[model samples]
Target: MNEIISGEKILVTGGAGFIGSNLCEVLLDSNNTVVCLDNFATGKQENIAPFLKHPKFSFIQGDIRNLEDCLLATKNVDYVLHQAALGSVPRSIKNPITTNEVNISGFLNMLVASRDHHIKRFVYAASSSTYGDSQALPKVEENIGKPLSPYAVTKLVNELYADVFFKTYGLETIGLRYFNVFGKRQDPNGAYAAVIPKFVKQFMQLESPIINGDGTFSRDFTYIDNVVQANLKSLVASSTSVNNVYNIAFGDRNTLNDLVVYLKEYLAIYKPSIEKVPVIYGSERVGDIPHSHASIQKAKKYLNYQPEFSLQKGLQEAVDWYWKNL
Candidate 1:
């Protein structure tokens, strides 16, 4: 078993959310004391309920938008994993101001708090949506294009602030540009839910799933476990790993049609009728890129990252989890 350094105290903002809670569990399993700070805007207490009994786990109900809460959470923390942000392109498009407040301004609060606390490292969740208008097949770290949405703009601002903090204040920050992350604990009932979990939930209920485009649009859907691994690795990664950005993805792409077939097959065990349900097609979402695939070369070389699950394998595990939990 891989273990976090002894006596290390860690703070995870948004630690009650899908990705944050998973990271908290892994860190606790690795023998680290964890403080989970969340306002529950998008997070749920049930996600972290299993860890409430653990001696090393603590939960603080707080929002990142508040400087006092951020400071309190950062006190004596060795590492800061900033996952508290309002995600979803449509949500941002609908309400850019609130999204900016949480994703951009809130991120600044955490960065300032972390720097003040003298934290060892600050790792944050960036997004592949930052690739924006770029028409490249596989996005590399160095190449980027104009942001297509307010959400992408905010994420790009996060990277910029992280870089400035490192250069101006000597803070060690690493940004993980996640590409369509999905898996267990991801909310499937919401209006802005990611495709996989949403589809699984609809299929489980024998509802027609909707595809945003002609089902030709593809994405590099990464599993949650891989994202957790990237967070852990980025924390204690070599000194050379700081002040960098890495694409945390499976490196493969899957179209919505392929995903539908896989989901139907997996869900047939629980709801046998779902196999016959066909997915409905809709117009392409505004501000959405046509294709997105990431080059993991940088993460592979610098972070020693090795993705353990392929799309099919990950989908199977995710479907089973949704079936059992939902």
Candidate 2:
């Protein structure tokens, strides 16, 4: 197994966002110098507020769409956790041009900068949506289907670009196909808010949480900490594991109904009435997969990514957080 990388300068591109900020916090805790670059379009100021005072933490207000900003952020950076991209399938469907600009062109810019700066490794956030329209129960890294959405297309392009960079330019790149990641600091007010945080917020305010489907659609709902661990492991993974992608997930499946039941069970501790809050079902979303469960065997074999939090454990943690913080 590879040891966790620490005590070096690292760049987290979306360090003000939920997953990136958590990575920033963990990197800082591990005695690393963290340079955060975020444009604050979707990333929040409060997400990184605590680290503003830290001596090793630095923030740069910049966009990945600009090559100059990418160049600036990668300077003197040992590793790059490239998380800055316009996320959401709906958002991409609504505005594919901008999504392409940020996720594809911007990703290329980051790759160019990383290569130019001679960075050791480039690890980025890939998506399960790349497994588009496939009937595969457990998604594998090598066996990907066609992209179902514009967002999925962008992610697929990112992987292709990464592979080219590694094979052609010799820039070590690792892609993490993140499942439905949810935890503290994930935005709950936006139209593109992730389901877990959005549901938690709605239930907290006594509003009915809406499920997009009949609650039977299942997902490999991964926790933020598991993702954080995957990122850390990617940083220190051996050279053989450098230029491949891994499924960063808990390797378990849960339905929307199961999620709601767990949420009610956990949130009931703070507000007993939340348990009585009815769930409203609506039409299933477009470009939404019926089921998404990852085979984390590849990740375990290569990155040694052992996810510490199960769905219930992580949901309880997230609920406790929202109850106190939301």
Residue-level lDDT tens digits of model 2 in 170-281: 9999999999999988988889999999999999999999999899999999999999999999988889998888888899999999999999989889889999999999
TM-score of 1: 0.98
Best by lDDT: 2
TM, every model = 0.98, 0.99
Give stretches of model 1 more than 4 Å off. 1-6
lDDT of 2: 0.94
Residue-wise C-alpha lDDT for candidate 1, range 215-277, written one tens digit per residue: 999999999888888888888789999999999999999998988998888888777889999
lDDT of each: 0.92, 0.94
Per-residue lDDT value at 100 in model 1: 100
TM-score of 2: 0.99
